[model samples]
Target: MTGSTRILVTGHNGYIGSVMVPLLQCAGYEVVGLDTGYFRGCTLGASTTSVPAISKDLRAIEPSDLAGIEAVIHLAALSNDPIGNLNPNWTREINAEGTVRLAEMAKAAGVRRFLFSSSCIMYGMSEASVVDETAPLAPQTEYARSKVVAEEALRAMADDRFSPVYCRNGTVYGFSPRMRFDTVLNNFMGSAFTTGRVEVHSDGTPWRPVVHVEDVARYFRLMLEAPRGDVHNEAFNMGVDSLNLQVREIAEIAAEAVPGAQLVLMPQPGADQRTYRADFTKFSRTFPNFEFRWTARKGAQDLYQALCSIALRHEDFTDKRFTRLRWLNHLLETRALDDNLHWQIEQQNVA
Candidate 1:
């Protein structure tokens, strides 16, 4: 293995990391995972590692934790929309403030490169023909705001010694070993397998961009190998054409993947917080050798197939009690553990 391949991934216990760790290993990276795997059913990699990163706070991380780290992929954060909304202050602290601190620390620790996994949701509402990297941002939520801060911080920190790559990705789908049924694509599969229909909570007419988890994770590995000048300080929106789908359209596409599935438009009591389409043209052009691949259909189909293989049922999706909003409310109302502690107590207490 190339000695320079030593890699450290924060959130290695996250939905993305569970799959990403193995993918990195397969690509010849000597992987190290740093995480607090508290998401219910969360796993810290496809397999355990001797160089395990304990469930520790990023702010309190010891200098020793930086051992052998050459490059870092910062994936740890409070990612769910509802979770972000629950305690905006807490979410910002970790997702935004903590990220800045970690990036500064990583760069200071002699790491040559850093990759940040930012969401495409940063472009809240499209104002232009389409959102290229230069498009003005319309961040709709606290989480998106936090990411925006982190993205800016990354740009500010870009210099000769440290190369930072920001991947502003679309909504991710596909089965994860540390599987989360919370994401839109996963929720669609979970709801359909249980209730025989996918519910569209919004008007279903908004334009949204979607990308498979495999492709998102794959792009990280690709960026790792790309020439520094070509990859550093640049943000790439990962995916092919951004599809303008009404929630109904996505439901229909998802329904086709699983037999007898249907789309039910759940009337919204209020305005929805998320709705936007991205312009991935700049990213495509940036990595001309890098390809825009994977369709939401292929992702939905792959997810549905994976869901069926597992023994799950309707009760799984209907339990809105576990929804991000519900959990956030529980934390706020009950004051259990604290406003900032985990929202869900998992099957193993780690997702």
Candidate 2:
């Protein structure tokens, strides 16, 4: 966890990873990136920091990829529910199987700390008001199921030599080089900023724990540096209790952040009602001094300002590059990627 510690961040070209790599580098950690280049050209305004990266698929990770790596921050996956629904097998293959494969390789290579980038979405439709780490995982979608399966597999792999810590992050928001308008808050912010309207398809009763991208990176760094005894083989719900907001509340915050944005709730039957309010008591207790800097309002304002600076248009907001499912579908339809989600043609260099 010192300045000399070399970290391997998978999916370094994605939303969170794009933000995370630069932060880690600025904090003095030697960072290496590994990504398949699915969202390679997906930059919002400015480009992310470039690092020495292995341009390889997650499922195709080789042992040499882990060579000289001290810790592994596993973020590569199908990434979202719609993409998971697109093909369950790909989610299982890459997120679940690929994670274990990479962990096994990291363990063999004498990598001490393995930080799994997990999600609280695995606590699907919990009856409990505030679910914690001990909450039963009821993954409704293939995406959530992949995280659950991968966490279980990683837990089993944790031993004296290999320490696996699961950072169960919430719905992450805020700006990144590889920006995503697919997540709830980010989606709402993008719509509010670009279209001057925040649209809610559901009744807006579903609850989601939202976290800022910067705070997520900082917390992961904390986990990486903390004593192994504290975080080893454990799962921490990565957000504060105050960050848990209902869909309507999030939309309101987003709408309020934009100058002329209106809030429209067109509740339809059978909308995505998956809701869970994560209890971050454990995270607070573990990282006592650590603070979540961004609130829903503040994050919304930040996104609004960033969008304003870039002069983001409705076309850019609806661009496939910023949305994972649409972009992957485009890749498949265009035959850039095969049916197996593997790149058929050579990938272009990430800008």
Candidate 3:
């Protein structure tokens, strides 16, 4: 393998990671995985590939774990608002502090490229027609706040050797070994497939930039391949302007994908109205040749087919393993993980 071939992808067992690890392997990179295996059981289909992984918590990631890794694609986190709302401190400790600690360890171990998986959700409820990398962060939820904090912390660590690139992704959709129905597009698609109804909880005017899991992996590869001068300490909003769509648009697409699936619009008080249209000019300019293969309609159709192929039932759609919040809540309620989100003694022994 080449010097830059040995890459460590944290959250390699999670949604994007499950898809990404195999893609990286096919591209001739020696990929090592780092995940706590919290959702290893959450499989929509058999995984395409596997890697030698460190079954360790992000908070406990030691310097030795970074020994042979050349680059780091950090993706492990509490994941979303509901989970973060479950315990804000858990998000703060794991997502924010753990990210800094891992980056610090990577820097000390001479890992050159640190690709931090960030979210466009941090541009919280912006009035700007199009929020870009230069837009002021107004993180509303603990989950979004953690990303902002992680990026800020990583920025301070960037230097001549340690180059950290933040890829602020739009809401990711499509099939993964570790599938999720928590994200907007995926949730709508799942509902359409399983229940024959795609429900829009809001007025459907909320704008969300949704990207495919494969595209996310592709961009991560591009980030790794880009020159040091081009990407060093840079932040790029992932996804194109064409991807930005209203909640109703996404639901309609999902409904269309699954024939006979009804679309229900129920705009209510205090519904999730978080909206933002991300400007992807920087990402477009940086990687002029890179193409995003999956559009919302295509992805929804693909997801519908995937769901149908699996014979996915309502029970499976509601399974705790596939939903991050429900899974985490199950772990917490069962005492598999303590209040701090650390594994209990019994689980620790197995890990």
TM-score result, candidate 1: 0.88
**Candidate 2 to truth, TM:** 0.98
Please provide, for model 2 over 1-351, each residue's C-alpha lDDT reduced to its tens digit, 9 standing for 90 to 100.
Answer: 776799999999999999999989988999999999899988989777999999999888889999999999989888999989888999999999999999999999999999999999999999999899999999999999999999999999999999999999999999999999999999999898888899999999999999999999999999999999999999999989899999999999999999988999999998989999999999999889998899989988988889889999999999989999989988898888999999988777322
Ranked candidates, highest lDDT first: 2, 3, 1
TM-score for all models, in order of appearance:
0.88, 0.98, 0.97
Q: Order the numbered candidates by TM-score, best leading.
A: 2, 3, 1
lDDT of 3 at 138: 98
Cα-lDDT of candidate 3: 0.90
lDDT string for model 3 (182-254, tens) is 9989999888888999989889998999999999998899898888999999999998889999989999999
State which candidate, 2 or 3, has the greater lDDT.
Answer: 2
Please report how far candidate 1 places residue 267 from its true position, in Å. 4.2
Candidate 1 positional error at 146, Å: 0.3
Specify the highest-lDDT model's number: 2
When summed lDDT is taken over every stretch of 10 residues in candidate 3, the lowest stretch is: 342-351
Error of 2 at 107 (Å): 0.3
lDDT of 1 by residue, 147-262 (tens): 99999988999899999888988777677766666667677777888878888887776666777788878888888887898887988877767444555677778888888888
TM-score of the candidate numbered 3? 0.97
Winner of 1 and 3 under lDDT: 3
Each candidate: how many clashes? 10, 0, 0
1 against 2, candidate with superior lDDT: 2
